[model samples]
Target: MSRRTASRALIAVALSVSLAACGSDDGADSPDSSPSAAATEVTTDLSEKPEVPASDDPAPDELVIDDVVVGDGAEAVTGSTADVKYVGAFYESGEEFDSSWSGGADETIPVPLGAGRVIPGFEQGIEGMKVGGRRMITIPSDLGYGPEGSPPVIPGDATLVFVMDLVEVTP
Candidate 1:
């Protein structure tokens, strides 16, 4: 499939998974409180337009998840849909590939958490977030586009970084 087609397919899968998961709110109330402490320890800035990190290259096996702004609202569970604004960039070149912020305020996307619709690292990175939270996720190539990559925009074996603002969670 073409890159754009694959992306659309992924989004469709995510939406379907979100709808199915939302039908049964089994674990919505049992929010894990451990991440709250970690959120307090993080001091990263979460600008609407975030600056790219200056690192040359991160380890290919690493999946770094840092909370930029911790929210006091509901915790993001595994089978939930999160309304978010995000910017994705290549870790090596610091070039942005996609962004919800670029399309203005109404462009926030609903991402299915813990589903296999998105990259593996992205799914894991968003796990413990709360509504109104901001997070910075640095994903290795293995967990991102992998060996084949997205092409044109994303190079093969490229690591990716995302600055995400979780606006709300629908369980």
Candidate 2:
């Protein structure tokens, strides 16, 4: 299979696995909590993968969303399908686990919002993003892979960090 096709396949399997995993919800809607990574600066261009720096701070207990670049294009909502380029890493180690950029610079993966097609943290994190925007999301384990995790790539009860660039949002 081509790299883009392979990447899409991986996303499908990941979404399914995340849906089947069980964990308590820490309520991603809370706005009071701030993670250290939320203050990080986004140094990469919209066309390239972001370089996530290692953080020594303790893992956050709630979902944290920070905008690196705000876009004036379409807003992502529950029914919207967003095409984005993203990099996923372990929050503590900053070790990259996956990246759509790995498929190729021209590649973007489509994520169906509010359709239970992705982890809660990811769904919630991308909810309000607009096309051309960039965001850094810090996902607590409860909202990510949970206790079972994805294995190999992601450890059990692991916190995750994602840097995403919204390319488009379509209904």
Candidate 3:
């Protein structure tokens, strides 16, 4: 498998483990369920390559979702899979850590939306995205990797930023 695929798998496993440990299968208690005022204050621009602003710490609560491009195509919904190109970075430094784009245009990944297979913020972020749409998602630690973090690359209690382009949706 490619690095991007591996990363996605790892994220899925991590999220699954976390959720199982908590004995919650529905993700109802997730922080991303309700958007806070701070979550709506995020700004995003997708005209060119995305640039995330640096922050020292994660948002106290809530996940931020900002739309960059609204595509005129089929919307991605729960239980559906979305083919996407994405770049991930640390919110504190805006330093890129992973990107499907790095592997070229053909590297788009198919990810399940709202299946608890990914981080809560990511699952919620793509809820209304259409094929060809683009978005920037800011995830607080609680809604991301949480206090344990993803190890060497992602720090404990760190915030994450992801810029995603929804290429297609398969229901």
Clashes of each: 0, 0, 0
lDDT of each: 0.73, 0.83, 0.74
Q: Please provide, for model 1 over 1-171, each residue's C-alpha lDDT reduced to its tens digit, 9 standing for 90 to 100.
A: 999999999999999999986664536432333333323433444444665453554455777776667777877778898888787877766578898878885577887887788889887777778777878777899999988998777777888888787788898
lDDT against true structure, model 2: 0.83
Runs of candidate 1 with Cα error greater than 4 angstroms are: 1-47
* Candidate 3 colliding pairs: none
What value does the lDDT take at residue 7 in candidate 3? 100
Compared with the true structure, the alpha-carbon lDDT of candidate 1 equals 0.73
Worst 10 residues of 1 by lDDT: 29-38
Better of 1 and 3 by lDDT: 3
How many steric clashes does model 3 contain?
Answer: 0
**RMSD after Cα superposition, model 1:** 18.1
